[model samples]
Target: MALLAPPKDWYHPAAGAERLWIGIALVWCFVMSLMMPYWHFRGKQNANGTTYTVTPKDYLERTEKFVAANKVGDLNGIPIVQPAPGTDIYLLGRMWNWYPVLKLQKGETYRLHISSMDLQHGFSLQPVNMNFQVVPGYDHVLTLTPTSSGEFTIVCNEFCGIGHSTMIGKMLVE
Candidate 1:
């Protein structure tokens, strides 16, 4: 019965144990808050954060040109492009698919340009686990080097529409 009842005085300083726990919780929260900024500035796993404003029409034209110029073959009606070692690679995210599968060489660094033509999308590179947001009207560039050689799948993690499940794409690193 005594335990169920409130403290005799409704207003009173917290006990020593309660104060200690409160202090520990506050310190923990402060440390967690500081870690966010520290990781944002010094983290190695972060994206390059390079983006540029672009219209969907302009980006589509540029990507189409890139695909036409560097296309080596075709796979399931999609062009398979093999760009030179130092050139930029364009990837377009449209309604239900990623355009023009990319073939990259292992150990070579290339700038990958990603953008969405219709709505916002998520670019998730499987096996590597690299993810980036693909928004319309903006071009996001990621500089990456393929460390291994095999077929890597690019899955859309964002739900755009009914066909989002079929939005899987591919990258061939040789």
Candidate 2:
């Protein structure tokens, strides 16, 4: 049979409980909307600040220079930049890899500068519970202070290419 009927008043009335639930839901939405700014200014939760523009070429050059100056070791043909505490750390993610694994000291805050060279990537620092989006034109500065010393894996949560599953990096905190 045809899935049609003669047009009638299509308005569906709300039950008493449904009306009460709708009012409660609207109040919750308003509360959540207000909580965002409250947390942003007082939560001390994330390192996300005003975004900035970054050119891939310039970022690559900067990363190379930083790696060259701060090289302390290498892993899988990638130079490891172990900058001293209080120094800014730069890391690049492109194609399917996070370049120049970082080494930081425990209990010291680091201004970790992260950006993408090709496409958007996700920077997930495991065992420390920090993750952020790495965009091509924006530098995401993550203020990190390692509580314990260990080797943390940098796993990309965003899909980029066929090699996304194999895109893994490491960071040593000591």
Clashes of each: 0, 0
Worst 10 residues of 1 by lDDT: 40-49
lDDT of each: 0.91, 0.86
What would you estimate as the lDDT of candidate 2? 0.86
Highest-TM-score candidate: 1
Q: Give the runs in model 2 whose Cα sits over 4 Å from its true position.
A: 1-19
Candidate 1, residues 66-154: lDDT per residue as tens digits?
99899999878889999998789999998889998999999998899999999898999999988999999999998878888999999
Total backbone clashes of candidate 2, pairs 3 or more residues apart or in separate chains: 0
lDDT tens digits by residue: candidate 2, 1-174:
258874587567777999999999999999999998889889857566446688989888988999999998889988888898888889999988899989888889888888999988988889776778888988777777888898999999888889887889999987
C-alpha TM-score for every candidate = 0.80, 0.78
lDDT of 1 at 163: 93
